[model samples]
Target: MGWWKKKKSRAVVKEQTWDRDQWRGEKILEALIQCCDGKPNSIKFFTADQILKATQKHFCKFVFPNYIFMGNGTLDNHRMILLRKMKGRSPHPPRDICTGPPKDVAISSMVSDHKNFMKLVGCCFEFEYPVIVYYGGERQYSPVDLNKIVSWRRRMKIAEEVATALAYLHVAFPRPFVYRNMGLKNILLDKNGVAKLNDLSYCVSIPKGETHVKLTWAGKDYDYMDNDYIFNRVVSEKTDVFGFGVFMQKLLTGEENFEELCGWKNWREKNKFPKWLSSYMGEGRMGEIVDPKMVLEEEERCLMEAFLVLSERCIGLRGEVPKMVEVAKELRRSLKQGE
Candidate 1:
C-alpha cells in the first residue's frame, strides 16, 4: 500500500509539471504571434538545459535586484544577464497579455536595434515564466554610487542617453509607449561609460489617435510618479518626463535623504519643487544646490543653471513641459557647451 501511494504521488507531481509547461508554451506562442508578426525566428530561443547550465542552476554569485543574475552564456561564451520572474505571487497580477514577462521579451526584442537600449540576446520558455537573456558587460546604477559619480560631465552624458532612449520609444513605433519606470536603478553603464536604458516591464503604449492612456497605478515608487498620474490615473509621455525629472534631481543633489527632501509631501498639492530647493534655484545659488562631489568651474556655472532649468520644465514647474525629443536636444546642447 505504501509503495502504491508513493507511485501515485509521483505521478500527480509529474502531471502538474506537464500541465504548467503546456500553459507556458501556449502563452509564449500567443505572445510571439501577437508581438512578432507570427515569426518565431525573429528572436532566438534557448533550451532549458542551456539556460540552466549557463546560470549554474541559479547558483551564480552575481545577482542584481529583481532576480537578475550574471553568468556566461554556454552558446556564445559571452557574459550575459539573465532576468527571471519572481517565483511567488506578484504585487500586481497580470490583467492581460500585455503585462508581465512575455511583454518584456517581446518589447526587448523589438527595441534591440537601438544603441541606448539594452540588447536582448534571447529567452528560455521552459519554466513557468520565461527567462530573459541580454549581453552583459554593463553595471546597473544604484543609489549607493551617488558619491562615486564625481564628474558632472559623466552624469550629464548618462542623462542624455536615457532621454534619447525614452524619446525613441515615444516616436519610433506606430504606437507611442510611456516608460512608466524611469529611475537611476534602470540605467546601466557599459564598459565605455555609455548609458543603456533597461527594464520595460512597466512600458505601455497609447492607442492610436490618443494622446494619453488611463491605467491603474502599478508603479512601485510613488515618489517618482507625477501628480497628474497620482490624482487622475493618467499616463502619457509626460509621465516619463516627470519620472526623468525626479531622476535628474537625484543625480544633481546626491542627497542621501532624497525621499525626505523631495518626497510626496513636497509635491502632493502641486507638482513643483519644494520650497527649499526652489529657493536655491530662485536665488541663483547653483553651488549650494548642486552635488558637492561635482566642482563647478566659472564656465560650468551657466551650464548647471541651464540643466536646472531644463529639469524644472521636465517637472512641469515651468509653464509647459517640453517633449522628450526636446529634452534630449537640450541635453545634447548642454554637452556641447561644456566641451
Candidate 2:
C-alpha cells in the first residue's frame, strides 16, 4: 500500500514513449503513468502488447518467450516482480500439468501461506496463463542473474537458504511437495540477499508414504532434471535432488550447458562424471573446476573444495546424495566456518 499512497497529481496523466532498449528508471516511471491509466489505486497486471503499447502503441512482450524486459520499474525504483507464465515447454497436455509438477494454481494456493515461493498475483482464465509476480521488485533477480560472478561465501549462503526452502516444500505441507523445476535460473535473490525458489508451475505434492508420482511429460530444462524421473515417468523428492545437483554444478562451473561444455554430449548413454571435474578433483587443482571467471581467497579455497565435493554428492556423484536437510546443515556449517 505504501507504493500506492502518494500525491495524486505527482502521477501525471499523459501518453509517453517507452523505449525498452533505452529505458531508464525515470523513463519507466513516466511511461508507467500512460500504461496504467488508473495510476496509484489501479496498478495491476498488463498484457505484453499493453505493456508495449504504453510506449510504442504496438510492440508486444510475448515476442520474446522466457524473457524479462523490466516491469520492476516502480516509482520507488524498488524492484517489483518479474512477470511470467507457464515456464514449461510445449508438446504437453493440460492434465499433464497436474501430474508433471505444480503449476500456477499450486503456487497461488500458497501465496498467503508460503514465504519461500514467489506470489501468484493475477490470473487469466481463458488462456490459463497465470501471472507470476515476485514482490521483491528491483531487489529480486534470478539466482544466476545472468551469470554474475559471486563469492564462495555468498554462494554458500544461497545453498543453505535454497536447501532450507526445498526441505520446506518436501515436508511442510500435509503432503510432500516436489518442485519439478529446481534449476538455478528459477531460484531468485531477494532484497535481503536471501535465496527464493520461484517457478512452482512444475511443483506438485505426492501422497505421503508414496514413493513417487507418475508423469507423462518432462519439465523444462532437460539438462537440469533427473534422467531417472524423465525416463521412468515417476518422480519423488529425490527427483528434485537430482535436478538440484545439476543446478549446483551449473552454479559452480558457470557453464550454460554442462554436458556440452564438458564434451559429454552423449553423457546420457555413458552417465560418466564430467572429465574436467573428475580430473581436477583428484589432482587438487580446485582452480580448474571452479569458475575461471571467479577468484577465491586462500581460506575460501578450502571451503570451495569442500563445497564442490558436497555438490557432487547431491548429484549422486558417489552413489547416494544425502537428503536436503542434511545438505542444508552442511552448507550452514560451511557458512559458519567462513564467518
In order, candidate lDDTs are 0.70, 0.56
How big is the positional error of residue 314 in model 2, measured in Å on the Cα after superposition?
Answer: 1.7
Off by over 4 Å in 1: 1-17, 29-41, 58-60, 67-72, 76-93, 96-98, 137-144, 255-257, 263-276
How large is the C-alpha RMSD of every model relative to the true structure? Answer: 5.3, 11.2
lDDT of 2 by residue, 1-339 (tens): 111112432123121122211222232233333222333321234443333333232213331345343442321234343545444433133455352222443344443245556654442221223233434344534455525655766767777878888887776656676787776666766667777776655666686679788888775466656668867768888887777766666667776545555654566557664443544676666666676666678788888778778877876777776887788788889889988
Residue range 1-339, candidate 1, lDDT tens digits: 111123445456446557555655565566556655554445677766676567665545444554554544444456656454434324243663346666666778778889998778877655545567776644542322566778888888988998999999898877787888787767777667778787776677887899988876645577677878877778899999988887877777775545555554666556665543455776656666777777666787787778877888898888899999999999999999899
TM-score of each: 0.82, 0.69
